[model samples]
Each structure stands twice: as C-alpha cells, then as structure tokens.
Target: MAEQNKHLYYIDELSDYKISDGYPDVRGWDVKDIDNRVIGKVDNLLVNKEAERVVYLDVEVDKSIIDAKYDPYGRPVQTEVREFVNKDGENHIIIPIGLVDLNEDSNYVYTDIIDHRTFSETKRYRKGGNINRAYENQVLGSYQRRRTGSADSRDLDVFKDEIRLREIIREEIRRYHHDIDKDVTYGTLETHDASRPRVDDDVLIEDEIELSQRRSNDEVYDDDNFYKRREFDDKRFKKRTPGL
Candidate 1:
C-alpha cells in the first residue's frame, strides 16, 4: 500500500502513532446498521498521515451483507465494474469516520444514516489492497446520499428519529448511570434532566444537508485540504468513536 499511496497508512503500518488516548478501541467491534442488524466488524482504521488523524474504518463485512439483495436505488457505478468489484476476495468496505455513532459499553459501532439496503449495495474491495481516491469518493457519496434523503426518504426519516431517541436515552444512562425519566410521544424524544442535555460533540450525528458536487479525483488528490472536510474531521472521530 505504501508503494500505491504515500499519504494513507493502516494503523499498524505506523510505528510512532497509536490511537489517541481517551477513545475506545473499536477494532473487532460489531458494526450495526439502522435496523440493529449486524453488517460487519471493524477490521482496521485507515489514517491520513498528512492530517495525522483517522479518516476511514475498514470493515470486514458479514456474509449476510454479501448475500443481501442489492439496493436498486443505490449509487450508479457501472454494472460491469460493480460486478467485478464484488467478487469473493472483496470482503471489506470503508466508511467515513464521522458518519457513525458509538455504543462504548455495548462494544459496537452504529449508524442510522445508511440503511442495510444501501450497505449491501456498496462496493467492496480486497482487504489490504490499495484504496484509490475514486473508491473513497464513492463510499462517501453513498452515505451522504442516504443522509440527505433517498428513494425511501420517509422510512429513512423515521429511522433517524428513532436512532436519535435511542442516543438521547443512552446519553442519559451514561450521565446518571441509571435510567432517567423520558417521554416518547408523537415520535418526539424528550428528557426531564434538569441540567441541559450534555450531548457529546461527536455523538450528535450530523445530517449532510449540502449535496455539493463531489470533486474530481485529480482535483481532490492535489488539494492539501482534501481531508479537512467535516467528514474527515479528527475531532469528530476522536471524541466519541473507538480507536486502534
């Protein structure tokens, strides 16, 4: 990979660096989709050395994911190319760092923005192989599309609401170390905590509202600030998600 790409390295490839202190180590943690279905496990983290921060999670997908019916409304990669890419050796997928929520105690990573259907439809590459800029863009684009809204827009919105509610409840549990008074009425989540709800900066899952056109690979690869976007922000991953 070093010969293929000079900037990005797997965590194990770096001798001096380690997952920053104060974050859970999520390697091997189960990755669950919006429906609470396990899709994969964290296999490794891809770090951008220039940014000195982790950018993507390398997930070893479950068998179910491979067998899942492809999402017809998923991203439009060329049919021949996608068929070739989804071969047996390709068992891993890369997810952007900031697009997930963590359950530290439960030992899993979760995301409500991307659904199972979309995940199944995502293109996967061989583990430990070179991940080109175009592949990264495709993965990010898929997640971004789902977050902003998709063919199943109504269903996606409901799922997001439910996920938000669950996160709020979990935060309350972490705060009081016990279940706190909460009300779920009309699909709204409310808490009775006297103190203002202390939402972890990273834990608040962001909606990618701006559907800006993704930059061309040549353009992004040449830019020094390519990884400076919100999706690659180290603070977002460092604060809430796991490490190593």
Candidate 2:
C-alpha cells in the first residue's frame, strides 16, 4: 500500500512526474531578492503529491546570503526551531512556491515579498535534510513578520490559507507568460515533401551546404529512427578520432 499522507517529495526523487508543460522549470535558475541582488540558485523543487503541484523551492544560497549578519527582529519564538545560525554545510533553505516570480528573459527566480535580511535570518538546513512542519512554520513566520508585523506571527495559520496561496501562484504564472509572449516571433517551415517533412532536404541541410544525393534515400527512413542513425551504426560518436 502507498503512504496516503506523504506530503512532499523532491522533484528529482519522482521518476513518474515532471514539471507541467509551458511552465518554467526553475531548477538551476538564479534566485534574487526584491532588489534583484543575487542570493542563491534554485537547486530543486519540492512538490506536494496530494496537491499535484509544486509547494516549495529548495534554494542553495550564495555565500553573501549565508555569510550576511543575522538579524533577530523577526525571529520565531518556538524553542525547538529558534536557531537562525546555519550549521557548517547547512546552506540550503526553502521558500514557499507561491511567493516567487519568474524572469524568463534572465532566467531568475525571485521574490518581491521577502528581502535579503529576512532570508539571512531564516533557518537553514543541510542540502537534503528532513524538513518538518515546525521548521517550515518557523521560516514562514520570519517572512510573515515583514508583511504583517504581528508579534505572534509564528502561531498564525499561514499555510492554511490555501485559496490565497493558489491565487498568488496563478497570478505570477499568468504575468510571466504574458511577458515572455510579448517578444516571441513565429515562422513556417518550407518543406518540399509534406509527408516526410522531418527529413526534408530543406530542413536537414545545414552549414549553408546541401546534402549530396549520393548519400542514399535510405537515410530518410533511417533518420526517423534514432537507434538506426549514423552515430549508433558507426560507433565513432562516443570516441575520439584515432590519430587525434
């Protein structure tokens, strides 16, 4: 039987799932603060299996964010998770997925709601450490303080506001799609053979050179089958030339 309540999993750990079509896969994209100062790289995504969507970003912070002076202004009151100092090699942190925006042109994952100071003060964990509910709430409380300024931010039911969270995510994705589509241009492929356009001479020819007719029409049929290609047949693609 499968675990019914297993909530989160790293995107990579699931072989059957993948990022949705047309949505940006933010892994490896640079993360920036509100002012666009680079803070980290998005190392991975944490998906909620039950929700069938991404819920958090696993960011591997840059040295500046890791080394910045810690501020206690928005510290969580929870005794179990009040430590803001990152242990040696504990430079990974999680940001709620709904809080970030995408820069398709620059390929950046950024948040306008959170600042660099708040990030520095949030608790960090090992790269693949177990992230429990208490630690997640602690980090959320630290960020919530910047927006609400509530003294008891830690006790508030931030994640329970599911409607608000979904709205934020939808709005960000809509805006990002709009931005990227603004500069996109389209063109048509001029193919001589409509039935086999994939291997048409106009498409296959490259480097301002046409393929010689002597090369064989068998190439057209073989070209469509990846395993029957020259690379697999010749066995030279994986190896260096003998003399060189």
- Candidate no. 1 TM-score: 0.64
- Estimated TM-score for each candidate: 0.64, 0.55
Please give the distance, in angstroms, between residue 113's alpha carbon in candidate 2 and its true position after superposition: 1.4
- lDDT at residue 213 of model 2 (Cα atoms): 23
Give stretches of model 1 more than 4 Å off.
Answer: 1-5, 69-85, 147-214, 234-236, 239-244
Candidate 2 local distance difference test against the native: 0.61
Tell me the whole-model lDDT of each prediction, alpha carbons only.
0.67, 0.61
Off by over 4 Å in 2: 1-6, 71-84, 147-244
- Cα lDDT tens digits for candidate 1, 1-244: 3453555678988899898886667899999987889999999988887788788889999999888746433344665544334677788998877667687768899876677877887878889877777677667656655644532554455456646855765454345422332331222555545564433323323211111223425344645677875566545444453364
